[model samples]
Target: MSFFIRGRRRDVKEKKGKKRGLKNKQVLPVKKSKFDSGLDEEITSDEEEEYLKGKVNDIAEKEAEDVETAQEKKVRLAREYIQELRKERENEDDEELDDKAVAARLQEEVLESAGKLRRLVAETFLEPVSEDFIVLKSKHQKLPITCLTVTNDGKFIFSGSKDCSIVKYSIEGKRLGHIPGGRKGTENLHTGHTSHIYSLAVSSDGRFLASGDKGGIIHIWDGETLKHLKKFKSHRDAVSALAFRHSSHTLYSASYDRMVMVWDLDTMAFVEHLGGHQDAITGIDSLARESCITSGGRDQSVIVYVIAEDKQLRFVSPHESVDGVKLVDERTFVTFGQEGSLGIWTTLKKRPHHMIKRAHGCQAENGLPNWICSATTLVNTDLVASGSMDGHVRLWKITVDRGHRKLEPLFSIPIPGVVNALAFTSNGSHLIIGIGQEHKLGRWFKDKKAKNSIVVVSMKKNV
Candidate 1:
């Protein structure tokens, strides 16, 4: 098992070598929380040397103040390092706690929703999402915000709107500038299908931004300069969604044409395409270049595909539960759906660790399927939050134990109305909710002390 894990890690490193000259591979936010064992080991040896030096100071009373100052500085430095790690790890830990609370809430809601007899279900579960949070009302746009990106380092928020423009905002939600893909007010968008802004994916480092449009065009932007990096035409009919492979130059783009295409960001090349779905592909997540990918489509199926030995979509992943996935750890992950369906699965063997059905459905669909309205992954915490047409943003908690897995609905917070998209801050402490087909974009608090009122949202926060 360790070898398998090492092999995956090595694959990522090898791909970095392959990223030369192609599309610039972007750094993804680091998801692993355990302290670096190598660094810890190296620190042990250095600490011993430091202790020996301290012993020398102990024997030489000539410089007692200097020795005391050095000792104090060392200890203070160590504490500061630990605090930084904690800040980084806080989001991941919050996920664990959130999963616990959300799972319990979902258990009850699903039980109740199951009694409603609603079939084709798409239910979202969220918990005490602050009702008193602030919302930045877009004044000059027609399309609601459909997609958003926060730099891995948590510096900025880049939002894509149906208005055919990509807007960059500060981490707090302040609109800094806008990249017009085409006309802002008119429908003369540059998409091959039409001019609507479909979706957007910001690179982990927040240095690159990718947007998909209804016309099957993918635009890449320099996150800092807001300059156009490149434009790639899609083989799919209408580009609906796009995702960057974690820490790599490869990206996955899906479209209404029922195809998923993998692009080599460094080489500006099309690596492969996995086709067979009969409906439009709406949502996508890339775990790695060749390991696994999850996609949700209008066909009412959330499908998983395994990268083959030749680095192609192999169609080996499971399609049973079909819930949207949020990658928590290499061995643990969570999933959610519109029908009150959520599950936790392990890709180590493509099997579910935990499964729940009908968490938000009032009726049974007898088999006709539906699509989740909106879903977001806090890349740092691995928390899977999704909103449904049923007026809820559901959070799923995932527990990753070496070989054990636990996934449960952590909380079911209600939106004032239907939801279009869900996003959490880099710290996983705040949530920005875009109501589906609505004009309001709400900023909310996501903590244990979520009082009825969250912090006042200033459009300048861009969080």
Candidate 2:
């Protein structure tokens, strides 16, 4: 179906602003009396031609100027980016040690410093937009959304529900599909979980998807295909949380049985069980280093376990029930609890460096502080996000410079129901939240109007 049409190029310059009139070249009417007297009217043809030529010249000049300006802007941006990189490299070199005693120490320190600079630059490039955060999209899952996780590339969001199914959604909030749940029946019919799916995790490499259910079962799926790969029994009780070690196949699972178990993903084998929490382990997260952290429910404790040493360290209790735990950095982490307590702890210390007994204001009808059920940290930034049963999602910034750390309030947004899960997109552009009614005893109807839904929040550009 190839076809070619001969066309002439048209360089048309549209007029902008006020229209100019060629007053001198106005079309004159010749009088009949003058024609009868054999008189001829003088014409300004030369002037008219000169005026038209000048107009074209002006338009051409303006277009050329615009093109040059755009080129200059591009070059300026390129130069600034190059300069930033050079500055980072120079800073890396400026920290060189004078001592030749430890060559290994020098090389390691240099690489660490350079890596830090690179991360800082990368974060700066994706700084949240300055505009007001918006509700970009909302998805009704028709079941209580218990957990949600955004993929590493920010293309998809996987949500687990009380119905025991894992539904996948695109970034635009379109339902793509769902993974088949539950055990294979003898009838060869596909079914989902028989219990609530409470925890969801995606590997850092974006290759694997894992979900934990109320029956203490963990299901593994191919991240790209969303196909069920394997299912295994992990704990005696329900699995409360799951986290994958960054850049590794190792996975850490926290269960209501008060056990933290590490799994070898490649072989689907249990590596070891970490026992420290006296009650249910409600929240868990892995650090960039070879370690993981967990928070207990009824026992109200936060435990840090070092994988290399195969031991626990720095056990502390900050509240009655630490419901949410998030790793802010390799050394620092944050925890929130049922009493609305928010605490910042460092691996170097046994006690929390900063604490807020009641971080959120809303209280239940019984005067109990709203429990914070979930938390997540913005990568490469000091910001932490927490969602509570008070129907509010709050953001906080932590400062840890020179041991004088403080938790500063940034902002809070109200949700229609309890926020069960919270995660930031890999690029920090959107916040994916699982929101629904907080199931309560003898309060079945309160959740009737609370449609199970997933909310995607756009962040303030400058945030």
Candidate 3:
């Protein structure tokens, strides 16, 4: 019985060994088939390639983010530094001082330190003798060009003429577009101005162009396209002057009816009307503030209207008739008259702070002062310019020392025509003058040598 059991165990061991050998043979052949087909190598190569591409994309994204962060940090630091400087300046001033006076002084100091403030440097500007000035003219209008306005960017100029036309021109005196004067009895037709165009204004944003005419009509146009958009007929008489408040669509228009009307170009409607002048309102001007300065012709009055408060400040002018007005800054303004005088005024004073009698000198034949028909200021600078029939455009520099302000003669450019309108570019690089044979408002005098055209004077000697 022991021999039989031993023999059975040997048989069982042999059967187990045979089963292990069969399993090993099956697994080895399956592995050899996968390697020979190249499927495993292909999958591994594809996964490696995808991993490298993802890594490269992540690196590029990180670098871009780092660069952007650096730029943002630099800008933030600059803004913070400027704010700190402003705060330090404000703290150094006495708190009891007038806020406007302190702000004005602080602004000048800040702008100067930042190198943003520019003045007519006597050395560079004075060397440009009258002959150095280059004058370019465009003769598209048949009649006198009454008013001229330059866009804030100094790229385009719009001029209104007595022929009931409005002409658009480039800075190089190239005519871009023209709106021909409509025929008589065409008042109802919205084609163009039926009467003479007396005043023109372009908004600071260069989005709206406004023109006032002798028929008490105000037309709004697309500043870039010169397409008429809307018409306003609120004034009862001829609209003489139009001004747009700086950096806004608010418009102030003066008319021969002795009324000043305010309009909102955004809503295309009238805001309100201001009345104070006893005679015709000849000129109007405004800055970034909510106020405007207007000159009353023949009434001998200069009125400042505060729109927000509905209040007006009236000052008596020494001139026979104030013909033109312009704002030098928010707190100060300048005006010219038919008596050939230029008056510098401030909102704080009832009388002119300084006056220059016979600014452009007198007429040779009549022995009377030449009429200063137009005047302009170089935005925020101390530069002022006046135009007349005196065959020259005079520039004045405002000197302020210890609260005392006065005008110092800078120089004059020879322009042989009746300068009915004067406009300065935003950068003070050019002066646009509308020249004509007759005066804008009347035929009081004629310049036989002058042509009915628009003249552009390059202010910079090298430009």
Candidate 4:
């Protein structure tokens, strides 16, 4: 019985070994499989392929993650760079202060205080602006004063007369020099106009003076020496106005010849001619940009033309004959007409933004509104002054209501004669007025001698 049990155990062992050998042959290639030691060193073909595929996926995922991280780093760095540039630009814009900037800042502060005081006074008592003016000086003219301009520094005042001459005077009314009439033979005097001097303009630096005459002659002079610089034939008819660009040597002249001429002071040559008006161009003024010009004429229209483009950007008739036009600011301008109508215009619109019908306080015997001869704006203020043939000067305060500007009558000054021209000092401290007789076809008036006067009014100085 022992021998038979031993023989059966041996057979069981041999069958177990054969089964193990079969499994190893499936797993091993040429060597014994490490799976016998439970190390998993050997694998089937299907298992090996699965392991390689997983390894490839892992490496691909890592590479993709690295690329994404690099892109994110670039984005972060670009954002930082843009932020730094914006900060630098902001700092530069904030630090651009100069002497002019300082002066402007102080002026703005003073104006703010004054405006507050004015509002307070108006609200407290509902009182009118006092004749808040005092006559500083008055000088008589030999001829009817047609136009006048004050120097920016308030040191000199130039008066043009129908008598064909220009007179220079100190701010104190002291006579400085007389620019002779006629451009023919006077070497000692400026090549004055042979006809009536109707318009005058001074350079921004107060170094040059320009005079235009009824004969279409333009005379340039040294403001300091009163010497003739040059004489040019500008138009076929009377030259109505002259304006010098601020801080530049460029000049513009409007003529009854229906043309506006541009000149270069540095070259003393004509640059170009701007023409669009159908009738005589009466008034012309330049914008602060010096690239555009605003002109009005008897054609009953106002035209704004761009110099570089040589194109008329705007043309409109405000239902009246505009005799005078003046730019008050970059966006705003004032126009006065033959019917005493004053209108405010803007660059964005072709029509008048505001209109003051019957701006002059008086009417004519023909039952029509009196003529508005000239108009000007006070420096650094929203005050507009208009002169009329009725011998009255009216002041208007510009205000905004419902996003539209309106001119409210502030005060009126009754002078002895018809007001021909109006101007203000650069600082708005004084108002320079030119008065003359309103002659009808050579008929003299009662106050003919009383006319042709230059009046200097102290504004803020007296106030």
Candidate 5:
């Protein structure tokens, strides 16, 4: 198969301010007389070369236009299909012959149709050409927010940042002012990475606030007074994930050292290290009686662990290998980073019932960077979102299984930036996405054209 044909991909930027079909209109062909015998070989040769280039450019331009039109048509078709699906379930009964069979069949059908759209779109835009931001009620905080911890009541927010400080705010991102653990010395506030906070969590009662730092320390603070309650020197490695098990007075922290250690939140005492994974534990979440968690690294496998009766944690009955996993509910999860793959795994009864892989908006195969980060759930905790290294952020409608660890993606669309962190607003309407290179936050909504649409639709609406 060693054919000797040379190929190079060149990115063509759309000429700004040019209307559609303008390039084609400008490619008036050279007259036959121009290449006639009256002209010498050297005469007007440069002019002829320029004309030839213009002709080639014209052809390329038309081809690109056709590709763009086809892509738009594909997206329109997908929207129509989703609307039809919504309508199909409008009058349908849940107790037909087989609800499981019906859902599986419908999911398969949707996935097959989505797969057919892989050849439809051209992923050539660096920033989304159709990018738009629909503003929501954003809370402007005095201190830059490094990590967010939302209270169970959903009213109070606690933020930790590089200012070597922690502060409380409302849902709208307002500062509640210095608590006891507030950046004490005004002179030392900007001087140290002492508060180079990475993660934040709040107790269910909103009484306790906890923040973790790159210094390998986890600070437990009084939620109301903002005083340093207790600090745990838990791990030698950086504390990546930390959470409070509210119901049982337990605290959990995951580290780059590849272990999830359980602690007694009431006593602030170390409990046990849940250690079977071979890589860094990325995220941890707790469900009733069972704790769900994700551990992955360069090895590229995500394992879910649940605490056993003896207070030791073990992999859930079925060991599932996912590129990345984020649990939004006891039964639902989201997975990305593989197989034209945006997957939602539904594991209700100990098996993946519905698995949907949507290949609709992935980057082009030609020359685009195809790296996609892990999907994070925002907007009511049901919306799964992801951003590719190619600079497009995408959203997915997802459902997961609590028992079997299945994930299914119902719908998907693109966003902006390489999404490093995904966090939701107090209400599910807006999401704050951390961009990797930009280091700034961008907001994303469910709609494709959200600026004009959100303004018109949400002018009076609050969320």
Candidate 6:
């Protein structure tokens, strides 16, 4: 009887030992083989402690994963989103580069094949009947349009008006946007001009659009969205002109305060101010060079501001006022004045290289020469146009004969209103005109018969 009782006790002891080994193996996976060796094997105190620690660690890890905080989850998602945006931007940049390469190749082919072709002249193609013109008028701009500017791609046009508003139009004469002007005391509104907007300019890259007002305020806007970005208030008088350096964000502005100021659009800060004009600057133009050309109103001077050297090259104009100026090339420019004379000038000379007196002809009623209010040139071409109240917008062809440049009348388009501003598309395919009943500077004269509108003349290439 005693032997049988001892055998049962031994069997119970072996069963408990096997259960202990299985628990250790489950907790400490690395010790599974040792625990499976035999139920008779006894685990050390250190081994038992390690098994407990491993069990705790596993439980903590699972809890941490399940209890992830909302903030941590958000951070993970944000990291993934930013990575996606970076990838998209990289893809877009690659596409832009490929497109540019193809465009360059096409342009090179056109130039090479056309080498033997006759020199293209604007006169042969610019003749448009009255019906060929597209007139854009807006109810938001009830007053006369003061200035107009076209984008480098010839896709959009921006027009400023005496009503203190600005209207944007597509090349197809569709109104895209309108910035309504505020009252005089609403300068803090920062929506649109509170005074007459005299000039408008867009950067060559189509990233920035700048507008100047008669109240000496300059507003910078996003080129694509037309949203106001910044405002500059350094000039003390009416801001007469605004221009952007080609392929850059550098802006040059002229004012009636007899000062020209430079602004960097990238930094949204003023760079420096130039002082050379004795009177109000009426017109300003710039090209690829780091310089600008301006006409001095009543100063009878056409000054070229060399920004790099901080020097001014002043050319004396035969006309009295020198109301407007436009650069023909890097060194040559054209100017017109209130005295009804047009002058072609070069930076190398102090006087005009060529002068056309009474170019617009005298008025019939008063027998006085009609004042040439505005002028523009087809960049890098021999084509120029001038505007006045002379009942026509005259186009002139610049003829180069043995190193001498002369202006020859090509044709005229009968525009009834006082032509305040003119701009040519970058490719010289279209001519934009700003016409109004009253003069841009002031109410010096009124054309009751004229209408306030923006006219776009489409010129087909003469093949």
Q: What is the TM-score of each candidate against the true structure?
A: 0.57, 0.69, 0.73, 0.69, 0.51, 0.75
Better of 3 and 6 by lDDT: 6
Q: lDDT tens string, model 2, 146-216?
A: 88888888988899877667888888767787764544232135534667788889988878888888888
- Using lDDT as the yardstick, the better of models 2 and 5 is 2
- Alpha-carbon error at 287 in model 6, in Å? 0.2
Q: What is the lDDT of residue 273 in candidate 4?
A: 88
The per-residue C-alpha lDDT of model 1 at residue 442 equals 30
Q: Order of all candidates by lDDT, from best down to worst?
A: 6, 3, 4, 2, 1, 5
In candidate 6, position 133 carries an lDDT of: 95
lDDT of 1 at 382: 40
lDDT-better candidate, 4 vs 6? 6
State, as a TM-score between 0 and 1, how close model 5 is to the true structure: 0.51
Question: How accurate locally, in lDDT, is each candidate?
Answer: 0.57, 0.72, 0.83, 0.72, 0.51, 0.86
Give the range of the ten consecutive residues with the poorest summed lDDT in model 3. Answer: 120-129
Better of 2 and 5 by TM-score: 2
Q: Where does the lowest 10-residue lDDT sum fall in candidate 4?
A: 117-126
Where in model 3 is the C-alpha error above 4 Å?
1-124, 127-139, 461-463
lDDT (0-100) at residue 182 of candidate 3? 88
Tens-digit lDDT track for model 4 on 297-335? 667787777676666766576565777788766566788
- Candidate 3 residue lDDT tens string, 1-463: 6999999999998798887776544434544665466445545778888977998999999997776776788788767755555565645466544445556765875664442454654324553455445454445587888999999999999988888888888897678988888877978864779888899999999999999998899999999998989989889999999999887999999999999999999999998899999999999998777889899989999898988898988889876888878987767789888889998887778888799999999988988998898999887678888999999889898887766678888888888889999998988778888888999988988888887887777776432
Query: What's the C-alpha lDDT at position 366 in model 2?
Result: 66
Q: Tens digits of per-residue lDDT for model 1 on 1-463?
A: 6999999999988787787645665778866557753443545778889977987977787675555676788788766754554454535667666555555544644443332211211122223434536655444344556566566666676666666666676655576776765653443444321356666777766667787777677877787878777778765566767777666777788887878888876777888888657666656776433544555543545455656564432122234434345554333445665455566655454456666665555433354333355666555244667665444566665555675656556666665444555666645556666543542223221122212111222112112
Best candidate, TM-score-wise?
A: 6
**What's the distance in Å from true for residue 197, model 5?**
2.7
- True-vs-predicted CA distance for residue 364, candidate 1, Å: 14
